[model samples]
Target: MRIALGVEYDGSEYCGWQSQPSGGSVQDALEAALSKIACSDVRVTTAGRTDTGVHASYQVLHFDTQAQRPMNAWVRGVNALLPDSIAALWALQTTDDFHARYCASERCYLYLLLNHPVRPGLYHGKIGWFHQALDVERMRVAAQMLLGEHDFSAFRAAECQAKSPVRNLTRLEITRQGDIIAFELRANGFLHHMVRNIVGCLIYVGKGKYPPEWMRKLLEGRKRSDAAPTFSAAGLYLAGITYDPKWKLPHFVEPPLAALLPRMSRPGQSGCNMKIR
Candidate 1:
């Protein structure tokens, strides 16, 4: 049987989302728990592979298990075996055709900036809080330019192995709450490091380090060097994934992202809007 698992994790404790050789990872931890439950090794496929120190509030993965375990059994069993850093929020029975990665119709990411005079020890690993004060208004203006189909090569990490860089950025919004600055991006797809790199460029603009219009030029330029530095992975998270209802997976929603991004009329779906922030 196929099982879909909704996972949430604090990426600070692990190497990354994918299984690693030298260190621990969300994949390694989850696989360990699943192996214990199934009494056999299980390999799971995720909707996205986040970089080291990147977090996920609602990441999805699927694995094929022949154990005939009940959905609640898999959920309770995995949670029992897994550490506090990672969690299997829920498990659902899925069709053989349902795939967590390939079947995903959209992916969303949120990048946070701590704009203050000093970094708060309270949010040390959970947020990307910088000492420099960010102009959230300017960042919002700059983020709007990225709200359409484009070749996001400039924002992609050079090490990214994706075959293409073209993606439809359905939404990009910047909002501020006191010292917290958040960049929310939704897309039909994302290239590796796309959200972090875009946030880097916007930060430059916010700090008066780059022209406000430079982001649009950089997007058109398609040169990776034209973009800003890749922002810290601490602030980036796999906010959510969208799929057709036929997938039979429950929405793994989080409160932080729910209040930050614009909510659509339907759950686990996005509306067709191109207007930027």
Candidate 2:
């Protein structure tokens, strides 16, 4: 049986998603837990591989298991054996051909920047705090220029091994709430560190080092050196992913209309449950 698992993790202590010789990885810990649960070796393929210190709110992975255990057992068993930093939220039986990575239609990432003289106590490890002041409005306008299909060679990592630099970016949003600046991007695909590099360029625009109009010129240039330095990995998070409805697991039915209905209440009223599925 093939099963899809929803995951959340704090990447602070691990090396990265892929296993490495020097240190532990998210994949290593997960596979170890799975092996213990199933009493057999189990391997997993993830929707995306994140770098060291990069977080994920809704990452997905899939694995093939023997027909002995229930899907819920796979979830609970793995969670029990896994460390507190990583979690297996849920597991649903999937089709034999379902692939967590290749089946994804789009991926979204959010890069957080805390631009203030001092950082917040609660978000110390989760965010990048910069002492320099940033102009959010200018960053927003600059990011819009990156909203369509383009050759993103300039914004990709030098070590990126993607076949092509062309990608369709559906959304690139820059917004600020108090001193927290966020860059949200959605794309059909992303090259290695593509979003972080793009955030670097937008940061330059916010810092008055790069004009907003310069983004268009840089995109056309296609030179890797034209973009700003890549931003830190600590601030990046794999926010979510979209898959074709047909690829959704069999037992996991979409929520019913009654459950999907939204409530109308005053702004401060408390009974609200917004579920995205």
Candidate 3:
């Protein structure tokens, strides 16, 4: 039988999502806990593999198990043995054809950054920080140039294992409240370090290091070194994953991304909404 599970985790302490031989990765901790419940070796497949210091509000995975414990055992029971930073949110029986990675049609990521004169103390590892007054308008203008299908090699990490650099970006939205700036992005797919690199370039534009038009130039150049450095992984979140209705997953309807969104709202706010879809 196959079981689909939704997971949430704070990735600050773990090495990353994939299982590591050293046994410190999030996958290592999860599989150990789940195997105890199944009474057999348990290996799971995830919708996305997040990097160290990245977080996940909604992540999906599937594993095959001959053990016939109730769904609650997979959720509550496995969670009891798992580390406090990781928890299984829900579990459901699904078709064998369903896959956590391939079935996912879209992926959403969020980045929360603190822009102020002083470095962040409270959100040290939970959010990114920059010590300068950023021009949100300029960042918005630069972000728009990233929408639609394009070769994102300019933002690709050198160690990325992806076969292609071309990806369709469906949405890119930036909003701000006080010193907190939020970037919400959705895409059919993302290369390694793509989102963080994009954020870094936007920051460069916002800080007057480059003009908004420089974004289009970088995209066309398709040279990773020509673009801005990759931003910190601390603020990155694997917020949502969408699949077709046939999968019958909860996210088949509306994804639960809204739950992870930053709700920092203020009226007549100069640091406000700038979205491209």
Which predicted model would earn the best lDDT? 3
Model 1 spans with C-alpha error above 4 angstroms: 252-277
What's the lDDT of the predicted structure labeled candidate 1? 0.82
How high is the CA lDDT of each candidate model?
A: 0.82, 0.80, 0.87
* Best TM-score among the predictions, by candidate number: 3
- Alpha-carbon error at 171 in model 3, in Å? 0.5
Q: How close is every model to the real structure, measured as TM-score?
A: 0.90, 0.88, 0.92
- Report the lDDT tens digits of candidate 2 across residue range 180-261: 6667789999999898888888888988998899899889999879788888887788878788888754322222211312
Error of 2 at 4 (Å): 0.9
Q: Which stretches of candidate 3 lie over 4 Å from their true place?
A: 252-277
Instruction: Give each model's clash number.
Output: 0, 0, 0
lDDT of 3 by residue, 1-277 (tens): 9999999898999988998888889899999999999999999999999998899888999999999999999999999999999999999999999999999999999888878767756557777888887999999999999999999999999999999999999999888777678898899999999999999999999999999999999999999999999999988988889998888777633334344334333233344232312
- Rank candidates, TM-score, best first: 3, 1, 2
Question: Distance from true position, residue 133, model 2, in Å?
Answer: 1.4
